[model samples]
Target chain A: MPKSNLDLINDCDSFPYDTFPSQQSAFTGYYTFLLPNDARPHGLLTSATVQSMPWTSDFRIDHSTKTVHLLPASHNPADLASSCTSALSNLITKAIQTNTFPILHGKHSEPYPILGAPKGPISIERFARSLFGLTARGAHLTVYTRTVHGLSIWVPRRSPTLFTYPHCLDTTVAGGVTTGEDPFTCIVREAAEEASLPEELVRTHARSCGVLSYMGLRDEARGGGGGEQGLVTPDLIYVFDLEVGEEVRLEPGDDEVEAFYLWDVETVRRGLAEGGFKTNSAVVMVDFLMRHGVVRPETEGDYVEIAMRMHRRLPFPVSARQVL
Target chain B: MPKSNLDLINDCDSFPYDTFPSQQSAFTGYYTFLLPNDARPHGLLTSATVQSMPWTSDFRIDHSTKTVHLLPASHNPADLASSCTSALSNLITKAIQTNTFPILHGKHSEPYPILGAPKGPISIERFARSLFGLTARGAHLTVYTRTVHGLSIWVPRRSPTLFTYPHCLDTTVAGGVTTGEDPFTCIVREAAEEASLPEELVRTHARSCGVLSYMGLRDEARGGGGGEQGLVTPDLIYVFDLEVGEEVRLEPGDDEVEAFYLWDVETVRRGLAEGGFKTNSAVVMVDFLMRHGVVRPETEGDYVEIAMRMHRRLPFPVSARQVL
Candidate 1:
């Protein structure tokens, strides 16, 4: 049986992309093997899609041949170009630095309305897959708390009862925006569903919004039935800045959730560098928060580091594709 | 005969809302009333949306008491409640702000899906009585240019053919972001269509997008048959941000333009504030640019500010039903 969604996310945490063998590209055989088969070549606005994709290039001692053969179900096609090349490349580059990888697994090709109906939710299969691996149809909202001292943050945690993932800890408030839902609505809703926080609580410290993108070159088709098999796809990733204050309560919905907490700068830095209690997503998020001065190492006023060890393994290639 | 679309848009440059006293509204009053019969509560979500939204009491001026009604929309419904208290109260609030005294207009409802299909363009009549306004259906894009300098900006001069107040002349390029198009595609396409510039010339600076609500708000329910009332009548407006450098050659699309030029920050500040040009869009845009610090006071730029201004007028109280 396929792993649970939570389990897949845990997989990403367990085997991150940054830990791949990246001394050179030519020798990284398995890394290149998982190039997404854009059968139709369109991901964003087309058909045929595969989420939580995991590309692994195992390390072997065969110094003579230096053989890095493609793994199971892996294919390299001259025509099956990438809808989003940068996503893969990002994973590879990060992998060379570390040995683990991240992955996303979801089904595709939702039936849009032919007679003026809103496109419905993604397949249940896909949702389940995302829990196990890195899932598509998700959004990231960074809550930058402007406190008396400085800025603070609130990151959501993944629940254990999740249909897919199990042990892995992942993004704070990341989830799919169903066709009809707006991005803002999506984030607020997800934060509530997974963590059981009130909408009013989340909206209190709202500040500004921004977007982020993860993309690379385009390639031919490697997918067939999904959205990216036939058309052009741009690997896109956008993040919104959801600001909150230091005096907020995060009501963890169920046992699925362990707790809701606060984060500071140094703690974030330590987590990213030392790996005391986190994953790549946490590390990247820490880096981004640091860049914006949204999270500081210390704070005097209303601030608390809810989880000194809030990081969990996810099943994704948290690093880049090229370096691996 | 009532005004047609071309007359309202191309001729008057005002939005086509449900009018009162024959001026889009519920009652036919002395002033061109909005909100009464106005179907569009939010007006148009156009380029001007940013300037006139959220209806903060800060912008309102109450002369009766010669004071700011920090909460003019404040209610005293406790004394007057019977059967429909909830519905009545909500309506009163909406109505009070719907036409904020001076402008008498604000916010619009979601659009009625005028065009049946998403792939191609279709002529959509906002409303049967909606004939008092214009119906525009098209897409726009914001392309960017690159330079060693921080960033390039285009300020248009008020277009000669456009008898409207701000014809996007002080800006470099302007157009609509039609349905089914993302920001990247929209900007590039708009650059090509409005300025006759190459799509590549316009590059993207940031993905952070803001809403520009204009006065125009399309409502399709009154479009005679009332069968397809809930049309996707967007509060039509442009969503874009692009860059153009000193070296790029720009040719305004003749179909929608008369001439084109460039301006620097100082030039814009001096000209727009001093009434050197004939468009109001420039001033607000300059304010937007200035507030955002996208451009500074002194820089090697190109622009000519149009002497455009905002709708100084607003909504007032009416209705003998309550006042009676």
Candidate 2:
């Protein structure tokens, strides 16, 4: 049987607060990763990862409390950034050399900021974020056209050769919000690089329609592959809507996307019910349907729960002011 | 100093889960109100209110556990409804006669369903919701028009003679969702009754734009009047947006609204910062601003926090399926 719409949202927001205690008992348990001078835990670490830390004057692991504290060498923003980055780099290198985690092998030079660090924003390789259970921010845009029949959306299938969620359906354009990059710029850049959309058209037409947040659990059923499973993943996605004219054409700008499909509302709904779209992308699509009056309380019995679950309150501090 | 946009949201979602424990220590702790078959608490009752309950075989107030369980007369849905409603009606009458709670004096014949009731939906008077800390559902609609300068919204000033939040600003059209009405129907009816809007126009043009749920505390600072202060008020508002042509005019259909003003975005922003809107109305307005891209991460420091707080998870179940 196909999954319900509520199931799609639950797939993305699997780890609610009620399940935390139960999950702790079932798994090896996670350690709270706290930065210096911060009262809140900014990340989570598995027991094995906490034990493998070098403790090179930059970290303090407290077994009793199940916490790993980042000990910065200096209070200065510049000094803290460099010190923290170098320590994390060393840890990732050790993990790669020892074949401890295969996910780190996909790490690139791109640094994603750990939002709301005490002294300043700290940087970590994008691929390593899930290992620490850090919050990930990204921008996703849904491009559609209003045809005579109804609204049709431009959907993309991710490249089968890609490392994560290969061959899965995705939003028209989406990319991680890299360190020092705002969501607007990130979406515009992604639109051009991933969908061959003109910068001017995207800049002029993209409507910022708010955000969707969820505490996801990475697992094989939800398209988690080539990496560790059962990792706590907190994600905040800035959502955008773009209604393009019929003259506009969307082509695969790079190899990241395999192809594009212009699916109508019924087609999209059918695909969603069959779990054809990526987890987060399915959430975005549901949100679009709600905003466009497609999915409603009159039709969907789980309307209220679905809407509330899509905007789950993340555990970490997300104030952009904390970014350096 | 004028409040920022974040303050507008914080004013509505004031009672987050973090403050629940502290609030219990400061004030007389609240008792969890549970139905006989429910595993979760569906409402909250103040200690004083719990003590004053008639307890005529319809309730089981466990002082040690700080719980008030509703003991239904029978397992039948009709029997349960009458038993619960009569018991609550008696309670409200006693409170009104003894002047135990001023809020009950404003109670009417309208019955609001207790969503997610185990046996079936049992209802209580709408005005008595706060006394029992039950969730109140409503429908709010924002009407706007396109102009040469920018977008202009139809803002309504609530009637000065009203019982609650008199003379304050509200959405273009808003009203409580009665027991048997769905949100879409409720909004259309409210649009006609509140704003004198034609039913044809609203039914044709009103777009269901999702929902906004928040855990609000009823206090004087937040425009709560004619009632007891410091009551737990959980709200779920179904939001709709209608774009009218420039030729359309909005008139106050009834005494509920004193007047209507078509204010531009800047004017609305100034009014919001000046704290001129009601608490929930302010939240709805902020959502409108966000959906329209008037507020962005580039300008607002508390952008992410503001968005997340607006959708606080209500402690009670809100499934429409639970409503008969």
What TM-score does each prediction get for chain A alone? 0.43, 0.91
Candidate achieving the largest DockQ = 2
Q: Residue B80, candidate 2: how far off, in angstroms?
A: 2.8
On a 0 to 1 TM-score scale, where does candidate 1 land against the true structure?
0.29
Identify the leading candidate in terms of lDDT: 2
Scored against the true structure, residue A194 in model 1 reaches a CA lDDT of 68
| CA deviation > 4 Å runs, candidate 1 | A1-40, A43-135, A156-170, A201-208, A215-237, A275-280, A283-287, A294-324, B1-324
- Chain A TM-score of model 1 comes to 0.43
* Per-residue lDDT of candidate 2, residues B176-275 (tens digit): 9977788889989999998999999999889998888888777766555544666788889999999998899999999999999999999998889888
lDDT (C-alpha) at residue A47 in model 2? 73
Ten residues in a row with the worst lDDT in model 2 chain A? A19-28
Q: What TM value does chain B of candidate 1 have?
A: 0.40
- Tens digit per residue, CA lDDT, model 1, B1-324: 432211222122232332111123321221110221222221112222222324343223333322211222443434211212222234324544655212222333322222221112212222311221222322233334445543344655556556334344445555433434443465566667778777555542422233222233223422222222112222323234444456766666755666655554545555554544433244335424432334321220111010010111111111111110
* Whole-model Cα lDDT of every candidate shown, in order: 0.33, 0.81
Clashes of 2: 0
Question: Candidates' DockQ values?
Answer: 0.01, 0.53
How close is every model to the real structure, measured as TM-score? 0.29, 0.94
